[model samples]
Target: MAGSSATGLATLLPGAAEAAQKGVLTGFDLARRQGFPMLRHGPFGLIANPTSVDATGVHIADILHETAGVPLAAMFGPEHGFRGSAQAGKSEARSRDARTGLPVFDIYAKSGDALTAIFRAAGIGCVVFDIQDVGVRFYTYISTLFDSLVACARLGYEMIVLDRPNPITGLDCAGPVMQPGYESFIGRAAIPIRHGMTVGELARLFNAAFVPALAGRPARLRVVGMQGWSRDMWYDRTGLIWVPPSPNMPSLETAIVYPGTCLFEGTTLSVGRGTTMPFAYLGGPEVDGAAWVAALRRRALPGCVFRETYFTPGFSRHAGETIMGLELIVTDRQAFAPIPTALTMLSDALRLAGKPFWSDGGRTFDLLAGDGDTRAMLERGVAPERIVAGWQPALDRFRARRSGYLLYS
Candidate 1:
């Protein structure tokens, strides 16, 4: 576990401090500006995606390939391909990078000995991980990170993480902790659904808390922490350009509602995938848009409004068939509670659709919820408020456990 430690706030290069006064500087931004000092451990393989770029939108793989003295041996892509060409739950096949000509390996769905072999075959002793995360436990990038850490620890290799802002802000956390026996690629830890942590902070937590038990020791890790980032600053306020981390997660608006609405994936509802507004629009063929909106309006949820709408998705659920549902319009992000809001939406949708709403008898829903109790409560027609209230004790424990690993104030 030598060199297994996260750095404090990165040092700003000359003129960078003044530039940072205007907005936050990401770990990649600071590393690039400071001349890629972390790449000193040469012949490093990079685990990255389309979101791994500097402030000027320069891709890290390309920059590393051209940088002098930095031996970047290969590239690794997560759920999305390195260039982000694939869709959800898919990745591009192994190929040579068009720009850098570096060999690209698909690390999506890879872990344990299979993943460690990938690292061994790459002929590298270190891996640099950089990807934008939306701060939800089920988002999958963090899962990729966790698997990578375990593999690195097994192989006795080093892992350097380039941290980014949690687009939703790390002010609070909610939702149920992922129970044991429910570990999937979407969630492999006992963390809350809306895990209010950056990839760097999660790396620290994973290395210290979870990696040891799985790998027999912690990974030799280092996190290049971001400068100018605060716990309360959302990605929009950080002055960084939005790069879609996945094909479906196109905008920050989609990410804001994803933690809760993503639970719909385990249901019969079309979460607006393959449409212009995924996650923001929720509906199905049986849904009554007008009635759903009216019921939601009666609830008077904070920081958001529901509008009756109709959409025909090009792909994924209700394709080419116009479905009735309501669009979620978040008015004040600061006041919007995504999990509770979504729970309310789910309760209302269940009342409208009945048992059919629980796709696969709530198996997938239970996984997405991190526990089966949520689906069970919803099935019993429990109010979203009571369901959310039941989560406070667990949430409080998680928050307290999470505070010690937090890097940013």
Candidate 2:
């Protein structure tokens, strides 16, 4: 029920990338060139949103509809709705697309027999997923993908995933692995909070690792992988356009810090929701901006700097009340460790904000953190570093298990 974590700016341009100049072509682009012949078999559904666009900024649904005999039977919207018009915790009502005149259904929070029934009623033989993910566990889009996989496996429907870049890059994994009994809509498995794999690769992992264990078997899965993407290439390096996957995720910088700072959504603090800075700005009404900034600076977190700041949100936590917090300045994308930095920030914030620091009765934080251990450890006066150290073994095991699913080197 809570949102994601992290920080970023809109000004960072994508022209300074390290990859080749020819640009990375997404699965949707390649599928279009191949004439989408697979869809010629009657009807298939697309799970997409405003972010499912080609290199020239044309929507994939539009292209498929216009292509001769493509057979795009229906469209599906995830958490925020198909056009991404709805805000957090809400979705657009089921309606027909004004442009393509195709029926659009809402897939958020629907699963099992209910979900399979939707696909069957649409008369879709296959389901294609093309949403861009930020590579964090609590983002919900991935959770929707996980649920869809289970449903498809149960109903014997084929599933195709059009792979996209991990935006935050897929070179590493960090944060706590979700423990059993701690599963929520935000986390459906025991993977690390930052699972460091693209959606296609995750689909493969889900089919082989999670689905069989829970759903009784695997789905018919196919992943159309990217042509030139590698584990080290960041979003800018992909040479693709940046479409905000959600309202708050305005740029790639936002995605980078998200796996960490997004934990604030579970707290009493204002995670810059109504401000132009959003996740980049964090604080609460009781916070001492200067002291909090000083405490965070002393941690010497890599790849980032912190500054004392104050703001009043037009919406969400502490709205219209001026609050104090820190502004994250990311100096080195490659060096900035988001989970550690965010844990340290939380530790400092809790210590400084006193008794009423937490909100939602702490359930939200526990769910996003993937278990009760993080919140429990923090409440028991544990150092942020010590808490992070406790997750090493589990994180290591997850990394090893996930390697088999990696599509890019």
Task: Put down candidate 1 lDDT per residue, 1-409, tens digits, no spaces.
Answer: 1122432222222233554566888788778877887787668999999999887899988888998899999999998788999888899899999999899999999998899999999999998899999999999989999999999889888888888999999887999988898999989899999999999889888888899899988888877778778788888899999999998899999999999899999998899888999999889976677888999999999999999888887667787889888899999998999999999998888888744887888888898999989999988999899999999999998888787778787
Report, for every candidate in turn, its global Cα lDDT versus the true structure. Answer: 0.87, 0.84
**Clash numbers, per candidate:** 0, 8
lDDT of 2 by residue, 1-409 (tens): 0111111100101221433656787777666656775567778999999899998888999989898888898999998899999877677889999999999999887877878889888888889899999999999899889999988888788888888989888988999999888787899888888999999888877788888766688888777767668788899988899999998888888888888999988898888886878788998866788998999888888999999888777668888988878899899998999999999898888888866777878989989998888988887789989999999999989988887667677
Error of 2 at 165 (Å): 0.4
Best candidate according to TM-score = 1
Would you list the clashing residue pairs of candidate 2? 4-262, 5-258, 5-261, 5-262, 6-257, 6-258, 6-261, 6-262
The true-versus-predicted C-alpha distance at residue 331 of model 2, in Å, is: 0.8
